[model samples]
Target: MELDDLVEELRARADSARVSQERLGSLLDAVIAVSSDLELAEVLRRIVVAACELVDATYGALGVLGPSGEELVEFVTHGITEEQRAAIGPLPRGHGLLGMVIASPRAQRVPNIGQHPDSYGFPPNHPPMTSFLGAPVRIRDQVFGNLYLTDKRSAPEFSGDDEAVLSALAAAAGVAIENARLYEHSRTQQLWGEVLGDATQALLEGAAQEVVLADVTDAVCRLARADACFVALRQGSDVVVAAASGEGDPAEAPGEVLREPRIRAAMLGPAHIEPGAEGGTRAMLPLALGESPLGVLVAEWAREEPTDHVPHLELLGRSLAVSLGAASARTDRARSELLEDRDRIARDMHDNVIQRLFATGMSLQSAAPMSTPEVRAKLDRAVDELDAAISDIRHTIFALHRVPGGRPLSAEIATVCGDAAVTLGFSPELRMTGPLADVPEDVAAELLAVVREALSNAARHAAASMVNVVVEVADDVSVVVTDDGRGLPEGVSRSGLGNLARRAEGRGGSFSVEPGDGAGTRVHWRVPLASGDGPGT
Candidate 1:
């Protein structure tokens, strides 16, 4: 060959080498893009597609390790027909050739898998590969998945350059997969938290168990990405499904949970199961509050195991249990209070308004015969009006009965002050001090009575514009009721509080009334935060 011809051939080879370098750079760029992607499925698909392109291979598949990392599942793939996939019957539960890369957890290149003694031939009618390369996608020490590229167009061995580029791409893929998972988890946790909050609020809004529980289960499903969730309460020895949320038949999820001994034990403790005979993951956790186990919230994730969202699922699992426990306790307490309030209302109606109406009806009846037609008609009409009044009272009582009891004296006083502000056409300033959660009944009663009388006096006699009740608790708790009212009524004598003072002194506390600065009056009292240890004065 001539020197000029030889030089031209050498230059041509150099140009070809530069083109390969440029292609490798593009491949790395694609890999970086995959790592930065915010969705796991998208990242996985991108990785597979990039892999096929980088190695000049015809097809690629990405297999993410399942929940336990015991098995690799074909989670995402490229260059595969949907019909072919369906015919293959679910993503391969990685075994044989697939298991080699997973077990070794590094890049492996095979010139001809068919020639190998360890080769497991493809299933009949399955896609065949003349050349293959598998690289484990590692994020730190954890293997997220394996990327497989197969059947180069030239049917040649995978080059050393292909190994170097794919290995780097797999590392990048890790960053992307983990990044997407982090973003998705944050979004999911926030979404689930809002759901739980709304469910709690919906329960507080007061509704049937069916309605309230339905809201809770729905919220859990969306948050945890569960296939379904069922809410059940233990009724006698049996558990009844009050509400359910999920996809498909939910197997036994749609019905009362099987109370097999294994199930009962599992329910007593948290148990996460592989999903279905069909395949998936399910977890059941007891809703325990204090010593009593309330019930259970059961969740099923459709995959045999959680992929990148195990922590999110676990978070939701614990949250679901807490919500159920709290909601159930509220439900039970409300139920008990309902009965108590009904009895109280019934007694009040019998002893007060109902008896009064009955006596009034009898009086009108007695007067009926002695009167003329017009007079008898008037008396009869009075009886009818009285009967209607009785019905109105009964209705009010029924509504009030649901509340279970009058608000605690302290609560009532606070409400009265605030409610009367609007009615009295002013915004009342109210401040509370000390522990309100567990106030003593008798002390609350006496303090409220003092404040109530002061307010009533201010409205009636004092014609006062403002009232202030300051509750102070120490060794003794006190309510200082002050009013910018006209001084004590003439001839009404300040002796009205003689019994109140006795009650206060009897409890080793003090109650007194004194003139406020300028013209109003101030009544102050004290009682103990703890009782029965005070010295008698």
Candidate 2:
């Protein structure tokens, strides 16, 4: 109550007030420093560091809750080295006192964290901690995360003043975090737009589908910070990697991932992220436009990596599917136009060219009968040439009328047999095996020629019914034509068979004709599925 004691008390209180003001000013500067950066990760790091310094705590961390609200998806820390982090193993999952703070969304101060009833002991190699202070960071009404400080250096425990300062820093941190997140979201949108725009422009410019797909994969991998990215297309009952970007074998990881029933189900359903091999994660996005399922897009990254961009990746996949649909439509339109042109040309040849040539041949034939011997010979030659021209025109018309898109080998064989049936009076039974529809065009063409020649011989020379044709396509392609005829005639020229054999030899294959099982003839032909040496070699 004395005047001197009163003066001393007021002076001490004034000193404390001045210190508080300085601390508040420093906190404001720290908030500005953190908010100045538009990057979400850098903002989070600065917040944690500033929080630790503001409260003079030995360790500080910011744990960002996942969408589920019970788990920490990201944990940024200050005062923990990389070695210490590795030694500490995985980050906490918002359990114990951390969960209390998250569940309550209020500031908490504890003298000894280990003595708390809900305390979950630290993991192996974690540093000792006794005092604890935590405050929830909220963006608007939603709790974004919690700022935690432990082991105050200057006091036995965190006082009310320390809690108040931490709470203020956490509030400022919330605003900074929201701003950084918005900036990051905008940056991500811009990046995705550039990627999709580039891919769309490339496709519209007539780039090959493979090249466009590669560019897309590359862009996605870079954006996601992924170790690899790949697109798998449905092939028969399975999926195969169509495009890939990164190191290691792209097919190996994606092939395994595609086999999972969950991932397979997602190919026609929704996009999802799942754990992958070797401590990694995979984000799968179905590449589809409406009801048409194109395939799936897969991106792989380390398990610890952030997956905030998964939704963007799915969006990219949808954009790519649209591009694919557009490209396919363009190709179909071009094919239809080419088919129409071919049909028009065939009609003209049949309706006009053939008739004119026929008239010319007839005139030449009539003149041959009325001319002298030398002149008659010349007229006969002219008539023969005109007749040959007419025959060639008719064959050209038949080719034009054949189905476009290169009919399947089985279908082409059936047509050849049907035409031969008109001459032989019976249809040949046909059998095929081993991916005949996937045969290369050049190889298929040669096989078709061989089949036609064999069938022609059967109709003209065999002179019997019950013909059988078997076509097998494996690593090697082979065809067998058999007929229940009297057998090879004696003293046959063999020149036609010689030509067929030479055709096979030129392509590293073989052709042979011999007597059939009982009273018929068998023509055997074989060729390598890919051009190279003969089978034995």
Candidate 3:
């Protein structure tokens, strides 16, 4: 061979070798970028760009197979113009060349795509393509997605070298995708660990039930990336929103998500959905542990493609379920303790302080007849002791009933109001509304007690001639009482507001007092229901 031809051949080989090294470097960079960032979209974009550059192709695209392996969840293309992408339109699902990769789960190279009988000609607006290369992305037995490239830069066609590089990149992408997912999962678990710690600390601090619910909702929202985070108690036909972090009214959440139909089908297990509705995307995490469902944590997404955080979100769902079980158990215990405390305080006042005060009052009244200096002094001492006992009783009752933590509505209210009537000379006008037949014991107690307080205040302080009490049932049950007398007497201290405000403020209900036109005072109190068994649990 001539000297000139030999040097040209050596230089040509050198240039090809240099190009090969660059492709390998690009592949390594893509993998490293994926490892550094767990964001799925960014990782996917990098993967496509790297494959295309490695093969020196004009275009590259990646499509992720759906959970069912029947539909294409997403398709991302690199090096395609904005107008070109518009021409591509809504990504084709399972058809044409894309389906071949899915069905075979193997690599394929088409040097002359148009000449092949299976080419399935592209629309007129679609870009011209001559060469095509695609490889499956699989991790272990799970088929993750597909990596594809088209129209090699070489005028002739895609070389075997091009095929080899793309295949290598696909394999590398699979590993990176797996690693990124695992890293995200680990971080998510760590975050949930923090939430568990916070819940524990709040429980120890004796935080109120509402406080606990709020803390949980905030954590769930942050970790899940949901548009709305809600802690809902499962009901038959409706799931009441117990706590929420975003737009929808959890209190009024549709029952469909938590309905018996869904739960029974799901059987207290974790479930999800992208049921796109009202420009919102929703996913439900069943708050269950073992064989029971305590509640559900629902979240909405404002964007399509849940690819970003689905794996991490699943972890959040499981952790939230465990946390919910613990919270539910804590709630039950707190309520039991509250009821026991209320009863103890009520009994103490009735048996010890009330009796002592009455006895002392009697002794003082009897001694008053003597009208002697010594007797008068003794009488005065007895009266002072009696007053102290009454004050002690009042303090004990208020402290026990106004704990402001987790307690059943029915029991707490009954104890406070019933005691007031016995000690304050007025019986509350109790009313029952709604499906009282199946009302929860705790809820009933709270509502009834609210009535008792309003009545006690009206009779004892309002100086009303008559008191009317009514409880009604309907879409919403309400208890309202009216008295004909002076309204809140001037000089009434804030200490007395408990009797005035306890009903509304205590139970998440509205409490209002307005003048009854010509005669007296009217107190209104309302509480939303919490029985999750409205239709199902």
Candidate 4:
């Protein structure tokens, strides 16, 4: 017991302290590595691998719980090759011993996992293992999943130090998992903002509803990395597919999804996610503006794809609902303004133009009786023309006061021709066919303008009685006006005919004026229904 013995003891103690320090440093390094990654899947994978290496275990895994908190939705593993995983067959659900550890919410250490009373035995082709340790991973107060280690390399049992190290690693993993989720959530929110911004801008800029809906669907599909996305709006008692974008045939998605009860249920409650027929996941979110239901947004993705961003998808649906509501309000405002303007113009015509025309007609009639024979004939013609002008002004007032509703285009054209009959002294025969109700507003306006112009010209210049107006509305709309009267003079200039020709040509259509079968002039105007041009064209 001298200086030599004392120095030897000190050296042994120093060596032991150095070894403990190195082990602690290794554990710290593993913890750091686990916390570095921001991706949730990568973080979970790193945790499993680091936990296995820290505890000197031959196999390790991290099982993510499903929404029910009982089943394993995802299983990330370390120390197993792709072939080994394939051989192991499907991943283990939380059953038997795995369920026991998950339910307990604490660390579990077993010398031999096989000998445990709750063991369910491994599946076919699964590697044999002895000894087991598990720790529940918690993000805040919620248990996110569990970390598992089997077959401790240095000992038959997982020592207390190994259990402590794994528990600490699991705790660190939970924080890392939460951080990764927040990062992902923030990024998803940013993407959703961009999508909503685009939609709002499009609607504000007066983009068509169909175009806005398509843009929203495309943006959501891209964000969800989905195969297809669609917006279905409620029409009457049934839901109709409004707009869709994706890889699959759009026609296929609507029929399959609209048939699901969950989609209908979603309108009243929260969004629902279900397995799709084509080995994918389908998420349906109800789009509403306050208590009013607008439609549903459906998203489809591969079967194994992560749906953690579903909340963001719902946000997109809500944003789209708001945009739709705004667009509808804007349209209503515009229509109201138009109606108000029409009412004002109608009042002016009745109060001023019609009264003045009637007075002028009376003055001409009074002058007709006092003239000589030849002059009397000319004065009588002037009186007749003035009476016709008054009649036309009254008809214009009636048209202006008419409510703009779902009245058929054919009926409107007939009304115009009937008014023209008073001026021309005989009714024009009218015939119409095809889907006139589906005609766009601007096209209808132009068509009506052409009809009025043709009728006015016939009344003013034609010296015959019978007239025929035929309107056909199919994939293209055509209007023919024929009058049995004097044909166009050789040297006369017709500016109205030029305007009508320009109108037809601007809309990628045609207009023609030719002599009728025997006499009179035939005016033909045709325009394609799908031409993008409007009244200006």
Residue-by-residue lDDT tens digits, candidate 3, 131-156: 88989987767889998788988656
Candidate 4 has what TM-score? Answer: 0.68
TM-scores for every candidate against the unseen true structure = 0.58, 0.71, 0.58, 0.68
Off by over 4 Å in 3: 1-40, 141-143, 192-229, 234-239, 245-294, 298-537
Clashing pairs in model 4? none
Superposed on all Cα atoms, the candidates' RMSDs to the truth, in angstroms, are 19.0, 6.1, 10.4, 7.2
How does residue 505 of candidate 1 score in lDDT? 74
TM-score winner between candidates 2 and 3: 2
Reference-based lDDT, each prediction: 0.69, 0.81, 0.68, 0.82
- In the range 44-107, model 4's lDDT, one tens digit per residue, is 8999999998989999999999888988989999888999999889999999779988889899
lDDT of 4 at 120: 87
Better of 3 and 4 by lDDT: 4
Tens-place lDDT digits, model 2, residues 59-127: 999999998788898999998899999988988988999999988999999999999998998999999
Could you tell me which 10 consecutive residues in candidate 1 have the lowest summed lDDT?
395-404
Shift in Å, residue 382, candidate 4: 20
When sorted by lDDT, best at the front, the candidate numbers are 4, 2, 1, 3
Model 4, runs deviating above 4 Å: 1-15, 206-212, 225-227, 233-242, 246-281, 288-294, 301-310, 327-408, 411-415, 418-434, 438-450, 461-537
